[model samples]
Target chain A: MTDELVLRLLARLHGHAGWLAVAALLHPVIVLRSPMRRARGAAWASTLLVSAVAGLGAGLYPSYRALLKQAIFQQNPTVGWWFERKEHLAVGAVTFAWIGLLCHLAAARADSTSQKRLAALAHRAYAAAFFLALSVATIGTIAAANRSF
Target chain B: MTARSALTAASAFAIVPLAYAAQRCVEVGLGGELDPALVPPSPRIALFWRVGVSLVLAAGSTGPFYRLAERSPALALRVAEALAALAFGLLVAQAVFAP
Candidate 1:
């Protein structure tokens, strides 16, 4: 095929792939209960989140595309503009989830003093990282609003 | 929660940066780069890529990372490694190899 034809074909394929990825993602809600399934779900959700952010940033605006794109990240655009606004919301969700996960792990591993100490250290680091992600997300949101992407 | 649990959570959270970076590098190849005259600029795509990475981080944070961190610290690390590899591979495949 010609270069233009190839490009067009690739674009078409990618667009379909994105949608298919979304479809596959939708069928696994039950899997979230299993750690392994949740892992895959989370991965797919993250991938969708990336896809949604790209759509919004590209001037896709608030259409079905945008809604579908946002769904790719995970639900929760109801709190506020930033929280439920767009892709940035994922940061908050991820941070919260990580903290909860850490707590669970620590609770399970509390049999050892050394393990407890490590858990404490992990908590500090996780909190710091979550804050950093939120800060970056906030900055990105500001930039997106002002910069005209 | 105990110290070890906290650490596991922290490790899960800490992996975000690496995952985010991996997504950005690859997604840019998926047409994040700009020709300036296109309907959307490259910067917009780049920004989208950044947000996308965060989304992935969030999903993992809540679902996979959280579960892994809670269930097994070692598995959590493995998950991070797997994610990094997946992100890197996506970048290479989509940006580096795809037409």
Candidate 2:
């Protein structure tokens, strides 16, 4: 496929991933506030959702890097900078999401107080991850709009 | 602070600038120009803002990690810290030394 076609495909994939991340962010709050059993379900759902998104991102990284290199050489430094920051933050978000998932699993096995603490931690991590995803989405949008092909 | 919490906090603190620097490495290594608008007029000032903002964000981002350390098994916290530190180190090395 031509480079332009590949970039277009990646852009669409990024858009879908961005929306999926936004939806996943809502689950953490529900998990934190819901009753224990329901919260567990929410946590599981969010974990799977975020994991899928992260996986998609990982798959796309190589293409994204190539396009970024192209942009850099083309003198669209703004797009390059935005994309670099977005990818780094997205990786960080994924890290937090995994930690949150681990915390959720621990909560499932723990006593009430311990469960609460773990759940709280999981909530915070998920929230952070969500925001990071949003930042990535925003930056990506800006980059796409302003980038010179 | 418990050893676990301290370690988590430290990892969080360290990862931010490391990540930022690593990204810089990717840009510079790739021969990408830094956005002039984002770069301060002075190199020292630019570095200060970059490091300062990264540190603050990194510390704040670790709230969950700290909480996790408080309640999770010690092994879990240790593993997380080690992974984060290793990733950050590699990224920094890639940024600074990668051709």
Candidate 3:
């Protein structure tokens, strides 16, 4: 019971962090779209949050497999694959956010022409990150709804 | 975009393929699942090595790419693009032709 409770709590925290990460990822998208070129704070926050949230999910995976994987597949086979797809998309999310961050940092130091191009790339990258992160959160919720630890 | 920006874009894009490659690494090489065929993971690979390490390597590689771009922007651009293309191709091949 204690172990179950711990896994449950960790799962809840992971879900919450995933949502927070989605929001954080959006921050860079919005900030970059605006006249303000500031990206360090929000960009860093999003990248760190997404990476940590992904890490937390990793921490919970063993428990999830032991406790819930079979039940989830039994209940709905497709949801199981959706869960896998979620993981794949999460990889994309992390990459997009990292890409955005790298570009934003480089944009600050480059010449004006390069800066403009880098910043534009950052904006697009963050937007893609935000979209993928949101998709992951949604898929996660659906997966958990089917069966959760 | 300048050569440096080209390198940045290519390096950044490398993250996806790199992360997927990392997951494949531990799953196939170390987990005793040496099937030698690209397939979706059983329950997904550990994100630490998959995502975290890829993020670090892709991000770190950019620094060298930037310096190289400084000396030979055109060469750096070509190398970065080629590497990124290669990685992307490997990722696609794996995804599409999984046994």
Candidate 4:
């Protein structure tokens, strides 16, 4: 298949995955609040979703730079900058989701007192991830709408 | 939680901001031409540095951190939390301020 076609497919999947990541990240934020809640499943889902989105973004990036980036900058420099910051925050969103996943897994193995602490930490981490991913998704949507390949 | 797992998580979390900060510093310090391919795009290395530094740090930090965790779990947790807070602050500052 052609590179353009590949990038288009990746762009489509990335857009869908970005939204899925935002939604998946919210699950542990709510679910892991209770001391009894493990949330391992939701935690893993969010991590995978965000990671997948990031991976897809990586695959699409070269094409993005060659094709859409200059055009977007020409249209609106502000949105172009927003896209830059969004990429940075996307790093945070994906990384925090990973941290939350590790924490959730550790929480499952820990003793009761330690488990609660770890789960609470995971809850906060997931919340942070959710907010960042949400911001990334919103900015990304605007950027794509403004100019996409 | 095991020390190894805790440290791995901490390393992964801490590296995110550290990687970006390093990448930014190198971009600014080394060359002005490579500032993320804005308009009159000349030869740019910003994307290469960004991806390369992040990959290296994320891959390299876990082993040393695991050793640290083995020595002192309390210290490891405290350091990780501090680093995570720093990471959060860095994100906000960059989002609001980066050109």
Candidate 5:
């Protein structure tokens, strides 16, 4: 694929991932908070899906950066700083999402007391990850606005 | 709750900085230049410094975060949520207003 096409695809993926992250953030409160087995199961499934999407977006970032090196990084320093910082934040988000997934799994298998604790922590991690993902997406949009080419 | 799960969470957090460090090293080692227009002025030195910083951050944060979660899950969750909100605000400001 052409560089432009690839960038566009990645951007779209990032956008969708950001939206999913937002949805996933609410699951801890809406779904996981429930005492019902079915709700907890749905929460677990949503966690996995959100993590996968966030991971995919994070994975594609390097390629996007490499492609835009000249147009974004080399052309201006301020924009480069913003983009680099955004990338770092995205990495944190991706890592947290994975960790959150693991925590969710552990929670599902835990006994009642442990399950309660793990679920709480997992929800927090998910919140952090979602916010970071949102930041990354917003920064990407801003960076694109500043692109020279 | 289990030792194994705690270890896994800590490891996961640690990997973030390691991955970032590796990416920065490769970017520089593979002929990626730090934009001279940015601060520090020396790309090679800046690259090494960044990698070192990342390593230090990973080492410093992983254990503390794990402990925090273990000791006070509620507090940990509150802190994480607050930080996330702060991060969001900062990024939005930077994007919308920063020169």
Candidate 6:
């Protein structure tokens, strides 16, 4: 029963992953082109949703480990700290990425300069989010590795 | 900067806390769970930080800068540039003082 449950969960996760990958590929092209841009906008939204799911999946493992470390050892706090901070950063990154993709898609479909500006803003926001996440993750990883565990 | 441009800026500032907040290490007692026990239950400081962060994020979400991004490539580029700078700063800080 346990094995069956695990398999079902894994299968669901894989399905979601496939969707996210497709959306990720489709979104950027939609940003540049027309007509298809509307369809792509929907895809972008879906992709962001999948990204959030994937991120949570990725986070769970580290979080679980952190919980174990805190519970058993109770001596070091580095890994646990890293886990939490990384999750927050990941959330921010995805939010920005979605916003950017949405803006870009809308701008591509738009005919006005003002609409284009919105697209650009979204791109900037996404980039900022990505970098912010990268920094936090990198630092946390290093800190955890060097920590007195 | 127009409304959308302003939102972008707000969003950037809102995210800045993520960098600094991650760096903060509050010494606390582990409770074998996600919640750690801080030595002192000082709600004021915690409240202040949460409020400040909420303001930043709220500004980004509610401001006009995001809307402006749809139209102005220049504004978008400018905001992107600023965020890039922030990202760089955050990376350096994390790398240098992470431990």
Best by lDDT: 4
Q: Give Cα distance to truth, residue B42, candidate 4, Å.
A: 5.3
Q: Cα deviation of A100 in candidate 1 (Å)?
A: 6.6
How many backbone clashes can be found in candidate 6? 23
Candidate 3 per-residue C-alpha lDDT over A1-149 given as tens digits, one digit per residue, 9 for 90 to 100: 69888888999999989999998998889889852378688888899999899888878876766566666666676787567657766776776677678767767766665566567767876886787789889999988877787
- Candidate 1 chain B TM? 0.45
Proportion of the native interface contacts kept in model 2: 0.01
Shift in Å, residue A131, candidate 6? 7.3
Per-residue lDDT of candidate 5, residues B13-57 (tens digit): 545545464555456457655444443333234433554565566
DockQ of 5: 0.15
| Location of the lowest summed lDDT over 10 successive residues in candidate 6 chain B | B25-34
User: Higher-TM-score candidate among 3 and 5?
Assistant: 3
The stretch of ten residues in a row with the least summed lDDT in candidate 1 chain A is A76-85
Q: What is the TM-score of chain A alone in each candidate?
A: 0.31, 0.79, 0.93, 0.93, 0.70, 0.52
User: Which candidate ranks first by DockQ, i.e. highest?
Assistant: 4
Worst 10 residues of 2 chain A by lDDT: A64-73
Task: Give the poorly placed runs of model 5, Cα more than 4 Å off.
Answer: A1-3, A33-63, A74-76, B1-33, B36-99
Model 3: chain B TM-score relative to the native chain B: 0.64
Regions of model 1 farther than 4 Å from truth: A1-109, A137-141, A144-149, B1-17, B27-32, B35-37, B40-99
Model 4 alpha-carbon drift over 4 Å, by segment? A1-5, A111-113, B1-3, B25-45
* Candidate 2 Cα outliers beyond 4 Å, as residue runs: A1-7, A34-37, A72-74, B1-99
Interface RMSD after interface superposition, model 2:
9.9
Better structure of 1 and 2 per DockQ? 1
TM-score of each: 0.33, 0.58, 0.72, 0.87, 0.57, 0.46
Worst 10 residues of 6 chain A by lDDT: A64-73
CAPRI-style grade of the A/B interface in model 3: incorrect
- What value does the lDDT take at residue B46 in candidate 3? 53
